[model samples]
Target: MLNDFLSHLFPRVVLRRNLAFSYTFCLGGLAFGAFLLLLLSGMLLLFYYQAAPDKAYASILFLESSVWGGGYLRSLHRLCSHTLLVLLMLHTLRVVLTGAYQKPRHLNWVIGCLLMLLCVFEAYTGYLLPMDQLALWATQTGMELLAIFPCGPLLRGILVPDGIGQSMSLLRFYALHIMLVPLSVMGLSFLHFYRIRKNKGVLPYL
Candidate 1:
């Protein structure tokens, strides 16, 4: 039954030479793998994380210093998040260079672009959750940079209500980083993969 469903979603030709499975150098699969790693590690970290401004940093410290494997999990999460960005960019460049975005694949290309942006946003939100000096200043600087845009104030308000370093702001970032953004990314990833199959898989190797 599962095989039939998958076969219905993906043509046999596409499945036979799946880009995700066959391409040795392509980083799309690696990006997806990294995302999965981030998801698992992030979930584990959540058990020990505190979203309040006062406790956030201290909790992280405890997690690292005391909790078994917590430090490694956090490191893995951070590493995968960074690695996913690089791999996604490389995969996108490969697609563009191969003219894979042409014709029926245009929608999937657009979806991929949105996924990349969401990945960046996910990373940014998580960055602020650590609530340390670096996270605080980095988030503040990011908001300040956003202020350069026409609707920067509105965007900043939406992202960091009550301003940076505040409890509410930390909570907002936590919600987005852990729940909303990840869910949206997962949904888009499903659509992106489905579209790839619908489009009869990736472009031929260039």
Candidate 2:
């Protein structure tokens, strides 16, 4: 039904292509698959995570020391998140250097920029999850930096509300790490690649 409707609306857009034999899938396709793996592993980790003072740290310790295959899952999640950041940066630079950001592709570039920021935001939020003294102090420093701005007061209400306190801040970070940032990045990624295909552009290999 959806395909019929799309065909009816844009009869000549040529939605179907014989991509099964194409090598183009090897690059972008694998990156997207990795992103999905990262998301799933991240969600699994979230289920066992705690955000409190002792509970959060102890939970991670339990995962590392006792839970079966817990260390591997945690390592996979961390590694993929870091890998995604690197791949995304390389993809962005490829587009820029290839002049794909010029003219009609400018909006795609904007979407790519947002996606990059979302990756960074996801990492920043996830860093505080371990709840170690280092994570706590680092988060504190970040909050203080935010507090330096006039908008900081408003952000503080959202970041660490009075009612929920420190745990609330943890919840907010978790939401951003697992939900908000990932969703935004995924959406922008779709737009970015769709535009790339529409432009019939190949990024030059360095």
Candidate 3:
């Protein structure tokens, strides 16, 4: 039954020891799995997180010291986030090396690029939520770097509104981290995978 279903979904050649399919280390699958893990761990963290600047740091401390498994959950989320970024870069490099960005798959390539940007932004916003001295300085540095661009001031204004470590800024970052960015990543990932399957899977060798 599984064989029949797979045969319908993939070409017979793909199932018959094709080097392209078999040789791939399934980096994309690994990245997607890491993303899902991050999502689960993040959701767990959300329950103990406070979005306001005043309470954010204290909330994290409480989670780490008081809540059961909180430290482990937070560590898992952090690890998965870093792993996802590395996996994404490797996956993109592999696609480029294989010339998988050619005509039929070009659109998916663009979508993948967008997904990468969103993932980075999501991580950045999450970085600010801890509200510790490190997070504060790191976020400030990021804002300063953004301000170097032509529209940096304007962009920073839109992002922080009042300033870093302020209530509005913390709330905005939290919302983008947990809501907007994740939703966009999910939508783009769906499109990216759909296009790959539609293009007959991972652009066979050469």
Candidate 4:
């Protein structure tokens, strides 16, 4: 039924794939699967976390020290996030080098670009979730870089909450890490993959 709908909407959908599997899907699938793993780990962490300052850090400690498999889950989440960033970058470069950005596939090109940006955002926000010294310094650096914009105040208003303590930033980061960035990336990913099917798959050179 899904195939039929796709065929009606995009005649090239059926033509997109060769009788053999696509190499692109292999790479994309790995990145997407890693993203799912990160999400799952994050959700499990959420069950044990409290957003408040005193408890938030304590919760992570508890996860590491007391909870079985907690350390492994945390490490897995970090690794997957890093892997997703690398894979997405490689995937984008592969698409671009193959001339996949031309003609009817230009929209997909734009979607791919947005996904890359979102991936970076996702990584930056997620780095702050652990609330460690490294995370704090990294977030501070990120904020400084963001403030370099001519519209620094406006950007700060959105990215930083005024008068609140350190936890506010962590909460903000966690929200974007878990929610906004994922939604945007996931939506654009659907558009990007759909375009691949619509355009009869990646270009031969691509």
Best by the TM-score measure:
3
How much does candidate 1 score in TM-score? 0.88
The pairs that clash in candidate 4 are: 98-206
lDDT of 3: 0.85
In order, the Cα lDDT scores of the candidates are 0.83, 0.72, 0.85, 0.74
After best superposition, candidate 1 residue 85: deviation in angstroms? 0.5
What candidate 1 gets wrong by more than 4 Å, as runs, is: 1-24
Model 2 bad stretches (over 4 Å): 1-30, 162-165, 201-206
In candidate 3, clashing pairs total 0
Better of 3 and 4 by lDDT: 3
TM-score of 2: 0.77
- Indicate whether candidate 1 or candidate 2 has the larger lDDT: 1
Candidate with top lDDT is: 3
In the range 1-206, model 1's lDDT, one tens digit per residue, is 34433553453654344455444375765798899899999989989998888898999999999999888989999999999999998998888877888887889889999999999999999989888889989999999999899999999998888989797788888989999999999888778766765665454531
RMSD of each: 3.4, 5.7, 4.2, 4.0
Model 3 lDDT at residue 100: 78
lDDT of 2 by residue, 1-206 (tens): 34433342245644345334443334444556668888899888977888675588899999888889899999999898888777777767766666767777788788778877877778878888898878877777777788889999788678777422266777788788878888887777666656655655444221
